[model samples]
Target: MTYTSRIDLSDHVRKQACALLQARLSDALDLEAQAKQAHWNVKGPHFLQLHQLFDSVHDEIEQFVDLLAERITTLGHVADGRITTTASATTLYGYPLEATGGEAHLKALAGSLGAFGKAVRVGIDQAGTIGDADTADLFTQISRETDKQLWFLEAHLQAH
Candidate 1:
């Protein structure tokens, strides 16, 4: 698709916004995939609860992916969300394929969510700096939800 947006922001700003959005989109996709990997393979005494929690987190991250993709398109940029694209662009570390225990999966997810949440906060500032309040607000929303999910995941690892 051609860049034909007239959303008041300059082409430069749109290009920058698309870059910011696309980076986070890639991270979000990676996070979702990792969570699903945990969901499907986690096994332990707390397997049922962890499985359910990971599934819920996966669903929420899916929302972030959709929102980001739509925002990129709204800016008249093609959202390059292909797996190959995300795999290359994502900063999230690869989830261990051998990690099948609840504790291991929780640890992996908490770390990834923390990293992703940090990136989203930076994204909010970057978008706002480019005068894209809409994108900034969107990132704010995603950040809030990401933090919540991170809390849920980390809670499982907390020492009583």
Candidate 2:
């Protein structure tokens, strides 16, 4: 266990950081689920590419969830990675039950990436305000990765 009495933050600051990370982790989990859904249901000519892309996206999101959890736990707080916690904390729209073709799948994935990227950017800014530069850096890394995935997914939707 790591101890850092030197790092003194008000309860509000700590709470805010915890809340931000909790939100991020939740969003990451939601993204993972949606990506898996897309991976499983994607079809059409670009099936192979989209299927692989969604799996990559899911992996990235899962990594972010673990990183955020570790950071929150480092701050002397309990990290919640459970389904109920993620459902309550996430801001993502519900995943559709019906299977969709490549274009619809890309649209949904792109929208999700955009929303998750915005949240991560906001969280990074909030963490920086409280002097938590490391957390901000982590979110920055996450944002970049999300954007790359967004690019890859969006490219598949463009005209040939």
Candidate 3:
């Protein structure tokens, strides 16, 4: 008797899922960096609040990054963590770092969350086509979480 394990199923589906994962990892890192930026450089009225919120956002993203990384490795693929790899892999349109005020800072953070949500939605679709239900579920979960942060970040931009 012999025991063997394979990703099984269509190559198209697996390939597509892998591609999505790669992009997701990149997006995750970009968002992570954005959260860090928000934590470090935000100033003005809501500084402490915004700073704490950014840290929370960073922590959640760290969790998701681990989940996605493991899933990638489980599928016989490498999880990219190097700066160069993350820079090239991210589909994100770059989160700005020079925004000094609270409003401007929140506005900038919103863009990264928006991009991450979009990418996760794409990942969900790709996972579905590839019959990777678990991966699809994870993407969906990330999308919802990202949406929450999006709302929170945007809220800071409104006058209160």
Candidate 2 wrong stretches, greater than 4 Å: 1-12
Could you tell me how far off, in angstroms, the CA of residue 84 lies in candidate 2 after the best superposition? 1.2
Indicate whether candidate 1 or candidate 2 has the larger TM-score: 1
lDDT winner between candidates 1 and 3: 1
Q: What is candidate 2's lDDT per residue for 34-114, written digit by digit as tens?
A: 999999999899899889988998888888888889878877678888999888878988776665798888888889889
Q: Which parts of model 3 have CA positions greater than 4 angstroms off?
A: 1-12
Instruction: For residues 6-89, write the lDDT of model 1, one tens digit per residue.
Output: 689888888899999999999999999999999999998988888999999999999999999999999999998899999999
Sliding window of 10 residues with minimal summed lDDT for model 3 = 1-10
User: lDDT per residue, candidate 3, 1-160, as tens digits?
Assistant: 1122376745555556666887888889878988898889999887898889889989988887888877777766677777898988787877675689878778787887888898798889779877988789989998888898888888766657
Pairs of residues clashing in candidate 1: none
Clashes of each: 0, 0, 0
- Give the Å shift of residue 137 in candidate 1: 0.4
By lDDT, the best candidate is: 1
lDDT per model vs. reference: 0.93, 0.84, 0.80
Q: Give the local distance difference test score of model 1.
A: 0.93
lDDT of 3 at 130: 76
TM-score of 1: 0.96
